[model samples]
Target: MLSTVSPRVADPNVRTALVETAARLLAEQEGLTIRRLAHEVGTSTMAVYTHFGSMEDLRRAVRLEGFARLAAHLDAVERSRDPVADLSALGWAYCFNALANPNLYRVMFLEAPIDAEEAESGGATFAPVVAAVQRCIDAGRFTSCDAWSLAVQTWTMVHGMVGVVLAGVFGPDEMLGHLSTMTVSLYVGNGDSRAAAVRSLARARRRMEPHAPIKRSDGAAEFERPRIQNAAP
Candidate 1:
């Protein structure tokens, strides 16, 4: 009979360290080698093998970790009285997740050879956006269009802007303001009244009011989101 056993990692924390270190290094465009990774995590190269099976597996794990973090942020957006406001909050949460984890964000989307499994798994992260859009449609705030399609459209617009900001095309300080502008246009076009869309946008922005773009020592600006309470699953 064949034995079924998972590999034992002497230190579970080492696995987390390896994944995070590799993601940060990959984002910084550092030359990644097994020895370098091991050195950074203060473990032998064998630990990587024990934890992830191989470097390719570790890369996939890193991408999955990025999605996990993103899902957490989306799940943090509570359902509000207005479905439109709730939808806007979901988009903001997605953007804030990327801003907070630029390194992981790059690894999640920019890396090549995205396998079928990884791609499918990553698609799950968009579920909340789709559900939120459906709520808007059900509430008669949006036209009777396909919810998934609109959600994808919204995601594409937001992700494109985020990618540009991450590439230093512009400062992150203007991101929320720009998102508000674009989403209002999108919502209005999809049958929502402009006044109601603006109101929803304002409500969403207010939730993140505790945070603003702050400059790092390197003088780069980044947005921070405060912890929201009573978030629905």
Candidate 2:
């Protein structure tokens, strides 16, 4: 009787190693081939399919991982007592993160699709910016504007600056930091004194009111009470 050889199942460690190798390749080349990647990883195209479903899927995973790292950078910025300062820090973090991870950064903001469904389902990869924008609004640093719109605006400004830097429109060290600062300044609108006073008053009122129960709105609990809180006398 002839002996039969059994096929090996893909190990998680091996799969992760392959993915990491692919991510590195994508980062370096920006346009990498699966055949080349498979050869580098000593795996078959079938293995890549089995592990990541498709090349698109793998790219999405890589981009998502990059966004997670970027979010962590933003999170590390100190929570400033001044909302404007905090907002500035958030914007700075966005630009810095992109500069730090040029490959992953390009994938996250520039290479991704602009479809509505993709935007809605992009998961944690996209949530950090929205959450950060909401935080600024909640802190009364930004006027009462839709968080989604503000998030897009902030993203546009930061991403535009990063793009200019990456495209060699300017030297990497020359105008990058200056452009980032200017972008943040434009977004914050020269520190409106009247707006800041209004925000302070609103915050004071919110803190004095008792916590109200959330009500069901279209199957979701809505916290109707204003978010800003006043200090105790």
Candidate 3:
């Protein structure tokens, strides 16, 4: 039911207009100032002040909205017995959120004026990820009883790569390639290598190369995988 519903946005509302305008303006040059944002949204600057109290407040709202959308995405994933796959999916979901909304994601993290409490509270947005890691621990698919730590570590791993790739410093293919092995390392230290997580991540599984259909060392499982071509340079 959560997935079935979109974020409850008040249609044609002044607050949404101002905040949404702020996010878009951030993506373009010479648009962040309140005067330009108001003109672009066909409203007076007073509306922005009235709606958000101040520019800093508007920035914080935009940042939180980005996390809110990501929360919607993580909530949408259907729970299954394949804990590794779900984890992989969440990583991809994290990346997708960044890639699809580069401007919003950037403000949510790099530019937002939120305080330490707001920053710490951002962890709650990833509760679904923590729950998935817990599921892996419960199913004995992963080691380490501290799912919270694993979840935070994994979130850090994925988000770091997302930031790097978006900055154009890292190629998409190279970053995505590292994602599997790096995430696998964490889980391996916890239990079995989660390269098998890739199989369920069709495109990523293919991107893993000749190593696709990774076999368990115990010969307990050999998963056939789907293929994917990474983004071209």
Candidate 4:
């Protein structure tokens, strides 16, 4: 008797589910096996092979998805009159994506060795940051520095800060504030634009945050909103 193949085997929805589940499992338990993933996804091990040629391929897909989502998040950030604010928005969006998908984030940034495909994915993810830096340079907020160098430096800084947060050394509340401030200061200070940097940071923070308080139907502020709860180290 021929076994019926699930039409979803190669569907994008199933592929996404498998990739997302794989990332979460890999993040929760480093060194996740294909067999385990199949068991968790409630499909035959063949499903893994069908969707992704192998576990390494699955991991690659997971990493690629992470970068894809990051690119979209950064893309949605409105490019406004404030170049510094625009750049800062990209910076924090990086962190927001990390917190939302720590397991996938780790896999994308740290878990595995990078192959040619992974390199391409990584480059695509950082292109927005480079563009944002260029905007700052054009606005005279970053002096004569090349956009690539500044982009790489700022990314390295944010990457290191996120690593520290993921390593349990720094809580998000404590470290994110310090890291973000330092990044803005470093960029603006390098251009002799300290005062402008201060204003940029203030404006960026205001723009990212909700000015009006979140109120319940009775009008009391929803003080219970736990901002930054995941501490997956």
RMSD of each: 5.7, 13.5, 11.3, 6.3
Better of 1 and 2 by TM-score: 1
Q: After superposition, how far is residue 136 of candidate 4 from its true place, in Å?
A: 1.2
Of 1 and 2, the candidate ahead on lDDT is: 1
TM-score of 3: 0.73
Candidate 2 accuracy as TM-score: 0.59
In candidate 2, the residue pairs with backbone N, CA or C atoms under 3 Å apart (3 or more residues apart, or in different chains) clash, namely 207-230
lDDT value, residue 132 of candidate 1 = 90
Per model, how many backbone clashes are there? Answer: 0, 1, 1, 0
Q: How do these models rank on lDDT, best leading?
A: 1, 4, 3, 2
Model 3: residue 138 alpha-carbon error in angstroms: 0.7
Clashing pairs in 3: 143-190
Positional deviation of residue 203's Cα in model 3 after best superposition, in angstroms: 9.4
Worst 10 residues of 1 by lDDT: 224-233
Best prediction by lDDT: 1
- The TM-score values for the models, in the order shown, are 0.86, 0.59, 0.73, 0.82
Model 1 vs. true fold: TM: 0.86
Which residue segments of model 4 deviate by more than 4 Å? 1-13, 28-30, 210-233
Candidates ranked by TM-score: 1, 4, 3, 2
Runs of candidate 1 with Cα error greater than 4 angstroms are 1-10, 211-233
